[model samples]
Target: MAHLDTLDDEVPDISPYVTPISPTNRFYRIDTALTVPQVDPESWRLRITGLVDNPYELTYQDIRSMRLADYVITLSCVSNQVGGRLVGNAIWTGVPLYELLQRAGVQRGAQQIVGRSVDDFTAGFPTTLAYDGRNAILAIGMNNEPLPTRHGFPARIVVAGLYGYVSAVKWLEEIRLTTWDGFDGYWVPRGWSKQGPMKTQSRIDLPSHGSRVNSGETIPLAGIAWAPTRGIERVEVRIGNEDWTPCRLGQAAGNESWVQWHRDWTPSGGGRQQIQVRATDGSGHTQSGRTVPPRPNGAEGWHTISVDVR
Candidate 1:
């Protein structure tokens, strides 16, 4: 867990929610294996095996030829600290996992759906997640373009609301259906929680940290907030020692996408000022105040930043 926590510093900061349509280059990527797996699409095959009644395989083209669906989903890494940039939103296009599993005829007593990457890194979630109507997919495209090699070239799994460790298996090659007691993926043994549900999170993008600004000038305090499968209902910002003030929200792209938010603030006196932000989900859940490090599960805490005004 200590090593995983340190990896958060390696991720470059990007305003994940500011642009719900995050550009491909700005998307944060964290790979467990030492080297990125090179997968030749033409030779790539997705194997469906294990407890299923019918084991089968599908090529990259075969997946594309199937009925395709596009969705704007936000992915958050469990290793992401409060205000971290390890989250991104993009329109993903792929075949539904439910449809694929149905075709394979998942047998009775099956309890988990495991996805194996070309690098041999594996991640699995409960079988119920595939059919839970949360829009799980075997994504082949991202932001209207083929997935970038570093971000899972051929295909990856995207499940709304879950942390990337549990659902964002990249360079995906195989899905095995098995029992709960069957196996543990890469992160499980590393001390991460099996069910990586994302916690409510928000960030401050503008007034770049440590930037000098004019005192008494009206400045926009803004950023993005997300609650995964549940949309962000509202965002609020607080100036040093002031009450939380509501901020206007931008149109959310989809139920699983992040929403943009901003509030205007005038600095009365300038020295060193701290800005804090928090969010409430559509389900009426507010971000927690107690800070927790990203470890066995996702992190929980309000995102705060400071800047100097001249």
Candidate 2:
């Protein structure tokens, strides 16, 4: 785990509203309040209320008694840079959120579920996605190990097909069914788009900047790409705006994580060169050409980097 520097060096040099980058290198923000004093599961309680036929609360042991399943999931932060460190893959173990909601009996006209975290952060998600068959889990374990403190220790929410901001609530405290008009989440109130969907993107990992390679030797270039809830169908690499060549993509582990890819490139001569990577999802949606910041929605565009071949 790496720590990131997200604090403003001085008090008033920049805009006050700028989102503080997290000290943890992980893409997601770590709630300072709740994370300070490690939350204990034995003393934890999850409350379900508002617009439900049966308003109730459950203790940690009560939730643990429910059926549990393990799933491999990938989480990506909406504010992550083009090749940022705000993404990770883990095996999560938890009960489906839909099953719990069913027991609570959602009332009619409920379009969203407002999720609250122990740190007072809130996220509003469409109720249909929360109740439908899609795997929306209240995760208790990650990577077959107890949830790491930085990744939401006691519990966190993991929903497919949505961006991390709305789906990955850490140190979950309560879930309340409500109408869309009833609430606005942290990001939504800050001018970010209400709806979030992960975009298809790829990155190169091997032959890092200033790497040296033999003039005529074949260098292996490897990386990963993702289209959450969908599989990656193909990956292509281009050199200097030339024709794109297909790279070999490894078999996908699951629908929610990234797919690894590798390609071989032989340097004709020793010089500086640029490489670009792009990917296509199972649905055949190509990556976007326009570049957009991660604030309003997810970032988009091909990832490119320059390297030197000696």
Q: Name the TM-score of candidate 2.
A: 0.87
| Model 1 lDDT per residue over 60-128, tens place | 999889998788888989999998889898888888898989988998878988999988888889989
In candidate 2, stretches whose alpha carbon ends up further than 4 angstroms from where it belongs are 1-37
Q: How big is the positional error of residue 247 in model 1, measured in Å on the Cα after superposition?
A: 0.5
lDDT of 2 by residue, 1-310 (tens): 2111222232222222211221223434534353443678888889988889998998878877888888766667788778665666556789988888888999998888878888888887898887555678988876666677677777888887678787788888898898988888888988888877777777777667566677788877777778877868999988776899999866555667667677788877668888888899988988875777888888888788888777
* TM-score for all models, in order of appearance: 0.92, 0.87
User: What lDDT does each candidate get?
Assistant: 0.84, 0.74
lDDT of 1 at 272: 87
- Candidate with top lDDT is 1
C-alpha RMSD by candidate, in order: 6.4, 8.8
User: What's the residue-level lDDT of 168 in candidate 2?
Assistant: 83
Error of 2 at 132 (Å): 4.4
Clash list (residue pairs), candidate 1: none
